[model samples]
Target: MSVDTFAPCIFRMRQTYVTDVVRMHLEIFIQPK
Candidate 1:
Protein backbone atom coordinates (compact mmCIF):
# COMPACT_ATOMS: atom_id res chain seq x y z
CA MET A 1 0.00 0.00 0.00
CA SER A 2 0.94 3.62 -0.47
CA VAL A 3 2.54 5.55 2.40
CA ASP A 4 -0.27 8.17 2.37
CA THR A 5 -2.98 5.57 2.78
CA PHE A 6 -1.07 3.53 5.35
CA ALA A 7 -0.32 6.55 7.48
CA PRO A 8 -3.95 7.38 8.09
CA CYS A 9 -4.77 3.81 9.00
CA ILE A 10 -2.03 3.80 11.60
CA PHE A 11 -3.20 7.15 12.93
CA ARG A 12 -6.76 5.95 13.16
CA MET A 13 -5.71 2.82 15.03
CA ARG A 14 -3.71 4.86 17.49
CA GLN A 15 -6.62 7.24 18.02
CA THR A 16 -8.99 4.36 18.59
CA TYR A 17 -6.65 2.77 21.10
CA VAL A 18 -6.30 6.02 22.99
CA THR A 19 -10.02 6.58 23.12
CA ASP A 20 -10.61 3.06 24.32
CA VAL A 21 -8.06 3.42 27.08
CA VAL A 22 -9.62 6.70 28.17
CA ARG A 23 -13.08 5.20 28.20
CA MET A 24 -11.91 2.26 30.27
CA HIS A 25 -10.21 4.55 32.73
CA LEU A 26 -13.34 6.67 33.02
CA GLU A 27 -15.49 3.65 33.61
CA ILE A 28 -13.24 2.45 36.41
CA PHE A 29 -13.12 5.89 37.96
CA ILE A 30 -16.91 6.27 37.83
CA GLN A 31 -17.59 3.02 39.66
CA PRO A 32 -18.85 3.43 43.24
CA LYS A 33 -16.79 2.12 46.09
Candidate 2:
Protein backbone atom coordinates (compact mmCIF):
# COMPACT_ATOMS: atom_id res chain seq x y z
CA MET A 1 0.00 0.00 0.00
CA SER A 2 1.06 3.60 -0.56
CA VAL A 3 2.52 5.50 2.38
CA ASP A 4 -0.35 7.99 2.23
CA THR A 5 -2.93 5.27 2.84
CA PHE A 6 -0.74 3.23 5.20
CA ALA A 7 -0.01 6.16 7.50
CA PRO A 8 -3.67 6.82 8.36
CA CYS A 9 -4.28 3.13 9.02
CA ILE A 10 -1.41 2.99 11.48
CA PHE A 11 -2.57 6.19 13.13
CA ARG A 12 -6.10 4.85 13.54
CA MET A 13 -4.87 1.61 15.02
CA ARG A 14 -2.66 3.49 17.45
CA GLN A 15 -5.58 5.70 18.47
CA THR A 16 -7.78 2.67 19.10
CA TYR A 17 -5.05 1.02 21.17
CA VAL A 18 -4.58 4.14 23.27
CA THR A 19 -8.33 4.48 23.76
CA ASP A 20 -8.61 0.91 24.94
CA VAL A 21 -5.79 1.42 27.41
CA VAL A 22 -7.37 4.56 28.77
CA ARG A 23 -10.74 2.85 29.14
CA MET A 24 -9.15 -0.02 31.04
CA HIS A 25 -7.42 2.35 33.39
CA LEU A 26 -10.62 4.26 34.02
CA GLU A 27 -12.52 1.06 34.77
CA ILE A 28 -9.87 -0.07 37.22
CA PHE A 29 -9.81 3.26 38.97
CA ILE A 30 -13.59 3.48 39.16
CA GLN A 31 -14.12 -0.03 40.56
CA PRO A 32 -15.04 -0.44 44.22
CA LYS A 33 -12.51 -1.60 46.76
Candidate 3:
Protein backbone atom coordinates (compact mmCIF):
# COMPACT_ATOMS: atom_id res chain seq x y z
CA MET A 1 0.00 0.00 0.00
CA SER A 2 2.77 2.41 -0.88
CA VAL A 3 1.86 5.81 -2.29
CA ASP A 4 3.80 5.14 -5.48
CA THR A 5 1.81 2.01 -6.25
CA PHE A 6 -1.47 3.38 -5.00
CA ALA A 7 -1.26 6.51 -7.15
CA PRO A 8 -1.16 4.56 -10.40
CA CYS A 9 -4.02 2.35 -9.29
CA ILE A 10 -6.16 5.35 -8.58
CA PHE A 11 -5.21 6.93 -11.89
CA ARG A 12 -6.15 3.78 -13.78
CA MET A 13 -9.47 3.54 -12.02
CA ARG A 14 -10.26 7.15 -12.79
CA GLN A 15 -9.35 6.63 -16.42
CA THR A 16 -11.64 3.62 -16.65
CA TYR A 17 -14.47 5.50 -15.00
CA VAL A 18 -14.08 8.47 -17.33
CA THR A 19 -13.97 6.17 -20.34
CA ASP A 20 -17.17 4.46 -19.30
CA VAL A 21 -18.91 7.78 -18.81
CA VAL A 22 -17.82 9.02 -22.21
CA ARG A 23 -19.02 5.80 -23.82
CA MET A 24 -22.37 6.10 -22.15
CA HIS A 25 -22.79 9.68 -23.34
CA LEU A 26 -21.81 8.72 -26.85
CA GLU A 27 -24.38 5.96 -26.95
CA ILE A 28 -27.12 8.27 -25.80
CA PHE A 29 -26.28 10.96 -28.34
CA ILE A 30 -25.80 8.50 -31.20
CA GLN A 31 -29.22 6.98 -30.75
CA PRO A 32 -31.40 9.84 -29.69
CA LYS A 33 -35.08 9.11 -30.35
What are the models' TM-scores? 0.87, 0.88, 0.88
Query: With candidate 3 superimposed using the best TM-score fit, by how many Å does residue 19's alpha carbon deviate from the native?
Result: 0.5
- Assess the local accuracy of residue 21 in candidate 3 as a C-alpha lDDT between 0 and 100: 100
Poorest lDDT segment (10 consecutive residues) of candidate 2: 24-33
RMSD versus native structure for model 3 = 1.1
Count of clashing residue pairs in every prediction: 0, 0, 0
In the range 1-33, model 3's lDDT, one tens digit per residue, is: 999999999999999999999999999999976
lDDT of each: 0.97, 0.98, 0.98
Worst 10-residue stretch by lDDT in candidate 1?
Answer: 24-33
Model 1 residue 30 lDDT score = 94
Candidates sorted by TM-score, best first: 3, 2, 1
Q: Identify the runs in model 3 with alpha carbons over 4 angstroms from their true place.
A: none
Q: Give the TM-score of candidate 3.
A: 0.88
Candidate 2 residue spans exceeding 4 A from truth: none
lDDT of 1 at 9: 100
